[model samples]
Target chain A: MGHGGGGALSAELVENVFLPAFGGRTLAALGDSAALSLGGARLAFSTDSFVVRPLFFPGGCIGDLAVNGTVNDLAMSGARAAYLSCAFILEEGVETSVVGRIAGALGDAARAAGVEVVTGDTKVVESGRGDGVYVNTAGIGLIPPGVDIRPQRARPGDVVLLSGEIGLHGVAVMSMRQGLEFGVEIESDCAALGGLVDAMLAVTPDLHVLRDPTRGGLAAALNEIAAAAGAGVVVDERAVPVPPQVASACAVLGLDPMYVANEGKLVAFVPREHADGVLAAMRAHPLGAAAAVIGACVPDHPGMVVARTAFGGTRVVDLPLGEQLPRIC
Target chain B: MGHGGGGALSAELVENVFLPAFGGRTLAALGDSAALSLGGARLAFSTDSFVVRPLFFPGGCIGDLAVNGTVNDLAMSGARAAYLSCAFILEEGVETSVVGRIAGALGDAARAAGVEVVTGDTKVVESGRGDGVYVNTAGIGLIPPGVDIRPQRARPGDVVLLSGEIGLHGVAVMSMRQGLEFGVEIESDCAALGGLVDAMLAVTPDLHVLRDPTRGGLAAALNEIAAAAGAGVVVDERAVPVPPQVASACAVLGLDPMYVANEGKLVAFVPREHADGVLAAMRAHPLGAAAAVIGACVPDHPGMVVARTAFGGTRVVDLPLGEQLPRIC
Candidate 1:
């Protein structure tokens, strides 16, 4: 099964296998993060595992990704990520110095994100049984009052906003693996998005949807939101930002930038009325300095996404079967 | 690296490598579970990953181990586990039927323990990059008011109660590998301990310490508590429960039951005054039906453990340098 692509196959796996066995109202919501009310306090929880190859990428390693990924997942639910549990599966012969460096990166990332690594576990496997390392992080976040953000909240006329340029993370990781330089270096956009989400929520509590363009990139995320909300999205290709270096890298590698992963970028759907305010708020944040509105949801063509090219042609942007770039996160 | 042993090597890795990088006040406690206060609610958080081989053993599989292990960790903190996040790293070539069965077992275990698998993640590694499956479960449990349990709380005169027989889980796993059986079949004692803890907590809220003798069995757990509290432990070898079947299996394999693994047993430290009540409460639960006062905390020989044999002889019970039976959980 092509489960890692975050496409139809992945959705089916969750719906048929996971949900049927672990189904509940909270999990059934299928949001980026699961929201729970515990002892009168609203909380959001999420987990993600990073199996990126070449432990050290251009701008980030598995450590920062493990921290920032879960933080971003919680942030997408309008929650303040507070604490994380990091569990590492290390191969037996990995160097202690390497482990120390990764842990240092993880601590730095957690500190920068304003979250604590309060609990952790470490297990080592036989040398041949595992890669150098695999990190799984589970996070807990506090959801603010009167704020609701979920994919199902998207409606017709909701404006879609992109936080910044895409494809940097995928390109950066791939560049390292291929040992090729495209004249200019492409550093991963790997980062924590909680502060950026906080800025957007400051504009209004009415934001409809928040999603990070991760495993399957913006296309999968948009398609998922559209499918969940029973809405359709129409994006103008020219409005979507892509750095020239990353664009050239993708071109050389025969990859679609639209479907390539991004660690820090997020796509939000805001109600039309508050679109300008939310866009302004997002643009002001350092993480979202290049934020731009690229699309809008429509009632027609429900559960579908289409992008209008600069040449005035429309093409369907469907989810890829499998990850175009495996383990790029 | 001796990471699987949960013994001296594991402790060194944590104290020397992990703690320095990911250190915080809560994490410094080094309890079975880390206690955190969020929104006025005290919660216990912990994580454990299972890489048990064969996927299935006599009485349990990785599924139940993954669920029960994390639940037991939270239970050690005197918390009622509420939710768990399960993450699976599956090898690409593994059969889907195996995955489905594991998920089914996991669901059943969670339901029986009264905990929900609220959020989860699945990532498939290319064939040969992983074993059949490795599961990582992170759990959250809420601690009741008036309950403050930690390893550092053990004190002189605290009675140590062993919940049940030792070494069953380890023998069960090894039995399947060796393809030999004792006169009586041995089954893994893998199970959730939350209910038993709840029952004991009903008797008194000040139970000093709770620990599951899992990887390095009672020796490692007791050594940890002793070292943490700056106290010593003295146990009667005759009083420690060891089922005949497990005892025979350990004898034939040249293993000591005390140093073998147990999944569903716990050792608790209770003030002498409340020892009888806590013992009665533990015996009332099926999981703790064999509960007995096996040891006591003593001021002499601080940070050490000694066992008085039935023949009027005493021997030091030191923590194993590495796991005698690896991946027994």
Candidate 2:
């Protein structure tokens, strides 16, 4: 289970097992999506399999997550998703009604995202061999001209901006799984980010890097960008937004908000000169109303991410060795 | 399990559950792959999930099947696969060596087919929640200009061609699973068909329809084409090739050779004028060495397939309700 935790174990699996076996320059980049040129069109291709334990959650279901997850991956590359291919693995004896509900959610989500579910496949396993349903979605999107966003593009002096409050998605799923009630109901931030990405791109196509803080969360995304660009990231912890309910829930659960996943959010590394313009654009978008300038790429301590505490002490924000929460996405 | 059998159940799932939910013309076509235009380029996209038991089979394992399945789907649309995305759902304790082996085979298969695995994802489930491994591969391919092929394009005068012998893949996996002994070992016809598709396209790009006789085998492929084209198909059973060993195994197993799965074979519907040239081209290709003109589309009894038996009687070949051999692919 740790292998899928989207932390050090996941990274190691990709680097040691998959990378060596499937040797290619495009895959070696290890970005949120692979950037490719096919028939004179710049395309971003991405794949993600969703296996969240519960079929339904506080704010959304696995179907929407399956659609939004791949959409967000493409959006991270500054691409507008054009089409998606969905494949479902269902365990025998699973109710057709359950499958119907999921299919409806998936369709609604794709339409909301303005992408088409063009091709798909379905397979069934013996009843005990699968967890009701598992969906894998692979998406194709077209990257606009002059847009080259990747982790490697982050450089010193780049400003890092975060789209919204963290920990809602993680807290929402965890609370439901554990059946823990809070004073306020927490909802998963599951959403498609294509429109928000387009708005950001409109400000300037020169955005350096974009990442959705999924799986391993904001900490992992920041650490990855820093490592890939060989730069240091310095974050002001106070500037990071955390919902009071999520903060209280995390306190009760002994989890760090920085390491919690956010489905509808994105973290961007932009040139300092365009930072204000991009932030303004993000704020104007409904999905990015809570956007904030949280950090900056620094020349010192290359390949590391450090956060300043409220009391002014600095601490390293390390890439998690394994997930604090499993199957949260 | 029947839902994934690629017969009536699978078709119903697509029509009743997926089609209504997805509500798209591209998916409604119900071909082996979906054809679309992106940035002025005609593209084919397809997805398949492989969950065959035992991991290793007589001729090939799940690895090659995962890669070749999606490639064949694209080829059915007269497209040359360019890129693939691979996602693995692994049980918690699956050996890394086992994953390594599968990965290695997948890479080799991709290279052999001249396609690249550009992006991928890995997810892990608890031990009892999953089989040892399940692989999902989604592919994108380029359809050459002036090339138009689809099941609906099969016309009344079109001649149907079978690429080679059937039942090898189904019998091979079944023998391994059931430990049934045959005098001669039956190896699966697991192979990539992109090159063969390219060869046939070379003769003429206007081939009406090309289908891989996998899952529900040649019978299902023929039935689907006939139904989609709203034409009647007449097949001479004796003209269809079946290896002697495969024939004996199916006879002992009480299975119909036409209903058995084939991984490396294709059935093509061609215009009568170009039939000879297309058949010649298929025969010249290594994958289609035993290509045979097994049938013809006729105007009578539309949406049905009838096979001529040795006893000089024509019998309706019904679409199978469910798979005779599950997970054969």
Candidate 3:
């Protein structure tokens, strides 16, 4: 088989990768479409794909990762996440239990996020044609009244805040893939950012930009924002947080903490005047307990991002020059 | 490289499989997303996948496929087709072109869909751990009150119509995989069904169930409708047209004409009184000149479909016992 099989394989992908990530009451309807009530506002729609390897990793798996990834993307834009559609690709011979666990996790996570997995599809390939399972999730959310946020809105004087530590997700997943287990648990930083987003919105309706560092990590995300907003960004390295385990792993792997992915964290840009209020709201959320003002926009570094080192040295953080942890996300 | 890359292999799959079958504007967009308005609706959607052979096949593919496929999927759903988030699995090696093409295709498809490629991710695989590219698409569609239709609405007195000849799409692509050219050329029926869907909706507000028979052919579609609406469908075999080239190819391959897949074609069920009006409307469209009233819904054999044979013998059509064509879609 190539892909798009409506059988066990397809079932596995959905059960494993998607259902766990996005399963909810609306999703329980199992209808071809998810019926939703937006409470009246334009919908902010988004979709995402997850082709992670080892499909199963420490802390969380692809199922929850996929669900939260899309939900967070929608939330970043200040949208109240709603329904989701999933599609899957399975390499033949993948264990049914693995898929089942993934599905269960995805379902749990989605329910937690209050998002529903409405409709989905699956396809399977012969042993040599595909990976174990690859998932794609498309989500829709309604933007509440007075909440406007986008990368372009990061003004010159806006404050850049980070929700938590970085690289835990990439390192946790990598450790599992490499069969390395730490005596102390180090969970992947996989989590849905919707709650944190909501809290931020509760305090600052005019938040400028919100982004989660995934594939290319914080550096990739911030640089993208810099380019999109046409504004320079400056951060104090001393203020950036990284767990000891994550830092150790990155150092040993010769990887940059800033370039490693983080699933549960978010970086936000808000009016300088509202930064403290927004930080307080973010810190109130468990996912954003480590929230801190990390940087601010500057005119001179348009589309450029620089950081003051822990050694008090300034270094320009250019766009990722090479692939980071290959596909640690 | 995993799927979604837009490199040589991806190109080969497109040229050899998808392009010949689904050539059109949707293909032309080739972006991270497609941009289009649903006229009065404030919604966007599309669907697609990149299940090309040689998984890590040409160019920076797999990753890109995941992006483009989802973007296209949303387009088919008849929405503005806003944003996409991508996931990937990478085999060892699978160079930059692999990543670039996938990234590029995502960029291209998004540009074409008139939507932004907002978020994404990447993952690596152990050698022999995963195949190259296997893309899946999950899209959204905005439904306007006046354009209500679904598979379950086929009334007993309604007529059946097809966007184009059946099986050509499946035949074209299969022909490529088998290396059995039609001499006159048989391309894969890989195409985006958005425009034609739009056209169909424009023609009749009375449109009922609209289905794209990617796998299991037109027969599968009809059977599905029969089951969904709890009605019998009887087709005048003669009226259900097939291209000479397609028929000839099927004959040599020993494949049933009704069991093949179709990428670009759609089967529609409409009220009997409106069948002629809809046929005329479809035939006038470039992609639907072969549109016809192949059958009608009836009260007999509830939940079943019967196709009057060319030899005048009636045959029961069921959802192809298992799957007649695997991965055809």
Candidate 4:
């Protein structure tokens, strides 16, 4: 295991190792979720393991993060999540109260997302062999008819819309982990995006691509889509919204907001004609009130993402070599 | 996390913590797998985490065990596994070659089991926080029409049939971990049982209950079924089949074969009228050549399992308070 950071090392691991070992057409697509068909019904399947440190955070904990992470992945495929399987690995001697709180949080999150935890497993390890608790969730969702969303669908003239502010989750987790007091406390933006996704799908089911920028942040997500579609993404740096506190924290910590994780946000690549309607729908949703048109897919500089700065200078926003914040969820 | 054993503590954790936290009719059943209806298709879903020590065992490695474990869980619900999602938490500094071997074995196992690895994830943790590698697999299978199976379906006069020999899997892993020589090398019975289940299902679709004797072994499985169905299981001690080598090793180690884990074996509760037909079908399958009728459901002493001793005495076989062998898959 080279590095857990969702960066070049992670990409290499998947390309060099996992892809060769687990060969199949769906996995080769490398989307946030895999679209599948079972018994004539279209489905989306995805899995994620949460190892976030400092179990409890300002706005959410690992419990809710575990539930939302996989749910958001399924939503990215334009699927409404229906069922999930949860597995927990706990360390010996860990407080049962801590586990109870986590389980309570998980239950609440599942209820809020309107999905059921249909099956689960629990395992315990010796005290020193594991962190307090690690959770893995795998989910299956129903892909509505006439909807197809994937990274490779990003083509020239597609509008790139971001759901809200960036970098709050990474900044929030890091501040709590290091005991740094930013004048204003920043809470993690961890929430289920299924409702927001459904709202956008109502506007149009012909979305080209939808991605939740979690690990490696917006930069990584755009880079992946660019590479997959063999198209360039040109962004208006000034158009991207960053809250005041998160901006100050990232500046003080020398972390770029572009590469910081956001748990409750999504970036969509939509056809230009439907972009206005989709943006309107997203703005109406509570979760996407601050949605903005941050960029657009371009034909120039294929397989790259370029940002036009306020000073009229252009720079490439590349995928980070490693994560700036590890275990941020 | 009192003990990582699938005994009293595990049961309490599920009953007191998980059950209340994740409440739904499907999960309330507490079956080996959850039977669900999605878009007019009946599906079986299950998940398992493999933390067995000594990644490479006598007969199989953690990779194949991960696939087969979840596959077997789904098969217990009489479903043919179609897809799986694998998530790996790797410890830093683990050799890439070792991961390669594990992934290779996983691919081979999935092919052998006739399931596809559709989606997966990988995360690396700092060394010492995790064992070399831990795998979690969640699978979904299509349940055929007219088949209804669950633990609560057992009733009086139902015959209990075991798929094959017991205790080899736990013994094989233990010998490797502690470097113990039992005179004869015992390989783990770690094969997928989907084909064997299919052969059994060919005879009839009205089987009552099916369980894979894994972590807590035959005793635990029987106790669970008896409790669920509010019936007693009466077993003829002489009729339960244990291999001679396994019996010898268990005797030397002061372990009872009755409480030892078996990976590729299953115990089925069949209506007495159909017992002979099902037994013949099981015996005809390669994985169930040693199938035997070890017990029968009875009305006396409900919610317990009793084994008739060779001396014609009956004794209750209580579930162990903790596991005799920890991390035996």
Candidate 5:
């Protein structure tokens, strides 16, 4: 019933269940956001629900996560997010002040992202029936002319640029859970990436693909794009940025940094000719200051991802059946 | 933290928290759905989340409720809903078959309403962290030209028409929860109202207002419109149709039929001159087969709803603080 680990099961659910049930052309594409033409205007629509436990966490809370997550999904489709609808389900007996604080956070986040919360609904469940509060945000964005981005648009020579370090969000959330710490306080990299994406699009609107490694982390995101584009991808493991603290946390916790989730990061596949310009533009943005060219699309093996280890050996980075950390986002 | 009972508390929360946090032009209108111009196209967007205790009920499940609820909200804006986004938060250890059944119901509901489910998201929570399933659906629709409908459009001379018999949906879920029968087995009136709305719009595009009576009953719906329009409303108590089974069930349960929710019913305020044509069109549709003009907007007692009893006395139909039966929808 619940297999959204961003692995084989998640794909199976979409292929065998959701697609067949919804039965629409755009839905079959399985992009992060659905792009469609309505009344002669191209628009992107997307939705996500935040159920992360302990509503407040290091660096951010579920409120901002809900806003940024959907915003990033819209950005992945090269859309300028304009409006958002926030619906919340709250459990009885929760504090009104808590809700007020979260709403403030959400408002701040939406303003920063340049989107307005235009419509919303609120429902309440009995105490113990829900975990504090869960937020669902659905957004609408306009796709600019001459901008076309999708996973299947990746080509053989496309460069894969990662926005920043991996595993910070997951590690941050885990550190606060059960009173465990890694000697250093790590904060979640949760922020709206629409501005960063707009910067990149300003450089070149013809970027092939863009994705946020959220649920299944960089590994799951890369695998999904490779499978969708029917192309092989190779990443230099050492080039992939993992902050020293995050690396040590993963090492002590027996977790793979590649499969740990990120909230404000994105991986873009740009044409080789425009890669340098795009990389430079990304570096100029605060969110992408650590942006690195971690990998590239290849034609050797289709529908797979391979990582070249520092030990001079290559290994397959398969999508995990389920995420090592659940509800990290 | 939870005050969404469609009553005074709900209104206060909206006034205090939501309006302040998401302050904007359309949101200030407090319509069922927000109408905005996006890329030179007029669009209606609305959202609702289903947190009904039982995932499945008599006539519909949470899936259909999630679909039809948002669809009806868009319909209230005089829009033809085009696309919908479904997001699910499922509890771990739930049965896959249950999710499948609900998805099938949602798909069927969307198809019947002539809308497509274009984008979706799924997230899972650990056991004991969430209810069995909660579904949130947000929809986009196109509003036709010159068809402006809003709650504040109700005038003193407008006629109020109700779609059908009330209190069935609330009773259906209540009966299932308490394992009690109403002797006649009341099924829920859960359904999409887009087609029925289209039928009325076909007669006249300038209908004053349309609102589906969900979460709140006919009384709450009328009170809200009255308060928003700052006009008094008078209802012929004998003319408001309540099925015998529902009346008896409410009697047995010590509930007020007027405050019981109805999912498939709508109350419309139309100009007196066009009331006959709109009523004729509403009756022609199966969903509104029992449509009747039970009330009229009045200039006396502004912002209050008066129910004229059979004996010549009148009673104020004030909004309740919260629903009598929680999670009925």
Candidate 6:
């Protein structure tokens, strides 16, 4: 049943859960959708579904992950995060405590991103029909003035930038799913990027394109951007950022470091000349401390993304034939 | 996977299948969510997930059934249909032709309601982790001015109306799931209700509440309304308006007609003074030709709903304890 039931359960979810955490007038209305005063800016809308296994993982659970994923997607489009709609598919027989923890995390996450979870739905499926819980979050954010960004805007001469270390989110989930332990607990790279992205936008308003590699990872992301923009991408293997622990984990699992997913990292394609300024901006943010100028756009091999190896071999990184990490979002 | 992949497979589900059949401008965005102008009115949003088994059943398959389900939900909120965002979860090894047929049905159903399926996603899960296919559709609509309908608005003396014959949707799925065919085919009454709702609004723009009895059926919906408004609901058993085939199916299944679902029908609460006018308008619509006045709101037994029996007995109807049809929506 939908939580709009306004009964004892709905009250528990709202009063003991949502209101104490993400309190907003529009959200408090509990309407079908929040009505916000957007000040006339065009809206950028995005939606994502979260179904990570072992619902609870290091760094965050599905609740915060769901909120952060959609918020980051909006940030990539240079939009100011605003309102969100959450839909949950819960398996029957799930512990009620897990539900509370997830709901509380959602409330906190929404407040952290300065957004409202104005509307939501909850459906219960038989234990076998579903995993533990799946969440679908959809949101609308206002794109501020003078921020023109899209994947198709990348030019041949643009420089590719990495915000931070990659493969953290991938390794973290894999470790938890397989019951593997790291001496120094490998935490998820799960984080919200509204603030960090805002800093980059402030310093370099003309940033061209931004994307977060979550499912198919950096390789798939670059391939998509290259194909969409009709340009080739060349990455310097030495310049790309990767955490030592994450790299080790990927090696142990026979996964490519470049193909491992990242939840807290973003790739930006900037005009060649503005790359220095953008890199400086990225480095100034705490979340982007490991940012680097890792690649550049090339016109000669349009629609292909080639990564140069440390041994001087260059291989084209194409879109994966199939999803390597399903339910990562 | 979480089924929001915007890639070749997703495009295949749309282009090779969805476009030629259910085409519209909004369907052209192909973004993460449907962005609509909404015609300058307050926006209305609704979402539903369909996990009905035996994907293709007597009345409809997953596509048109899902499209109609979500569209009807929006119309229940007294909104003018605009656009929809469709996300599909397909089990691996499922045939592309079957998926294409479902996509075609999606397009046709949207067209029937004068709505658009603007943006969509698709992903494949491992066979055991999912059923054949699950469709999640989120809709956005625009609420007309002076229409402030809500479940909490029902007051004493408000009239409860049923748009048409009930239990068709539930019976269709149940029979298909159990593989128990009746003497003749009793197809599910799956359809979009925008036209019927619009006609009702024309007669009484101030309708208090509207809802489609889907998963837990009419009994659950009425109980929800009563509890939400803190009013007692009284329905005459003889006035419930169930089709003979549906009643027969329910009797054989040992399920109460009131607890069975209806996809092509709606339950409306209108001010008593305007109830007749609204019913007349609903009767004019093809989808609501069997519309009837079922009950009325009462103040004496607050937060409760009771139905008078044809045998001069009465019983209280409350929300379901657990899902009646798990994963059906």
After superposition, which runs of candidate 1 have C-alpha atoms over 4 Å from their true positions? none
The superposed Cα distance between candidate 6 and the true structure at residue A71, in angstroms, equals 2.1
Clashes of 2: 0
- What is the C-alpha lDDT profile of model 4 across A1-329, one tens digit per residue? 33678888889888888889889998899998899899888999999999898899989999999999999999999998899898999988889889889999998999999999999988888877789999999998999999999999999999999999999999999999989898888999999999999999999999999999999999999999999999999999999999999889988889999999999999999999999999999999999999999999999999999999989999999988876887887
How displaced is residue B111 in candidate 5, in Å?
Answer: 0.5
The superposed Cα distance between candidate 5 and the true structure at residue B283, in angstroms, equals 0.8
Writing each residue's lDDT as its tens digit, candidate 4 over B64-182 gives 99999999999999999999999989988899899889999998999999999989888888788899999999999999889998999999999999999999999999889989997
- Model 2 per-residue lDDT tens digits across residues B1-329: 88899999999999999888888999999888999888777899999989988789988999999999999999999889999999999999999999999999999999999999999999989989999999999999999899889999999989999999998999999989989999899999999999999999999998999999898888999999999999999999999998999999999899999999999999999999999998899899999999999999999999999999978999999899987898776
Q: What TM-score against the true chain A does chain A of each candidate get? A: 0.98, 0.99, 0.86, 0.99, 0.98, 0.87
TM-score of each predicted structure versus truth: 0.99, 0.99, 0.79, 0.99, 0.98, 0.84
Error of 1 at B273 (Å): 0.8
Which is better, 3 or 5, measured by DockQ? 5
Go through the candidates in order and give the clash count of each.
0, 0, 95, 0, 0, 3
Residue range with the least summed lDDT across 10 consecutive positions in model 2 chain B = B320-329
Q: What is the C-alpha lDDT of each candidate?
A: 0.90, 0.93, 0.65, 0.92, 0.90, 0.72
Which ranges in model 4 have alpha carbons more than 4 Å from their true place? B1-3
lDDT (tens digit, per residue) of candidate 5 on B220-258: 889889988999999999999999999899998989999
Q: What would the per-residue lDDT of candidate 1 be over residues A167-274, giving only the tens digit for each residue?
A: 999999998999988888889999999999989988898889999999888999999899889999999999999899988998889999998899999999998999
At residue A322, what lDDT does model 4 achieve?
A: 78
Task: For model 5 chain B, give the 10-residue run with minimal summed lDDT.
Answer: B1-10
Per prediction, the TM-score for chain B is 0.98, 0.99, 0.74, 0.98, 0.98, 0.86
**Model 5 lDDT tens row, A1-329:** 22866677777777877787879999988899999899888999999999886789999999899999999999999998999999988888878888888888998899999999999988888877788889999999999999989899988999999999999888899877747787878999999999999999999999999999998899999999999999999999999999999998988889899999899999999999999999999999999999999999999799999999989899999988876887776
What is the per-residue lDDT of model 6 for residues A205-317, given as tens digits with 9 covering 90 to 100?
Answer: 88888888877788877876886688989999989888788877877778887877788889999988788888898899988999998989998799888989889999878
Interface RMSD of each: 1.3, 0.7, 12.9, 1.4, 1.6, 16.3
Docking class of 6: incorrect
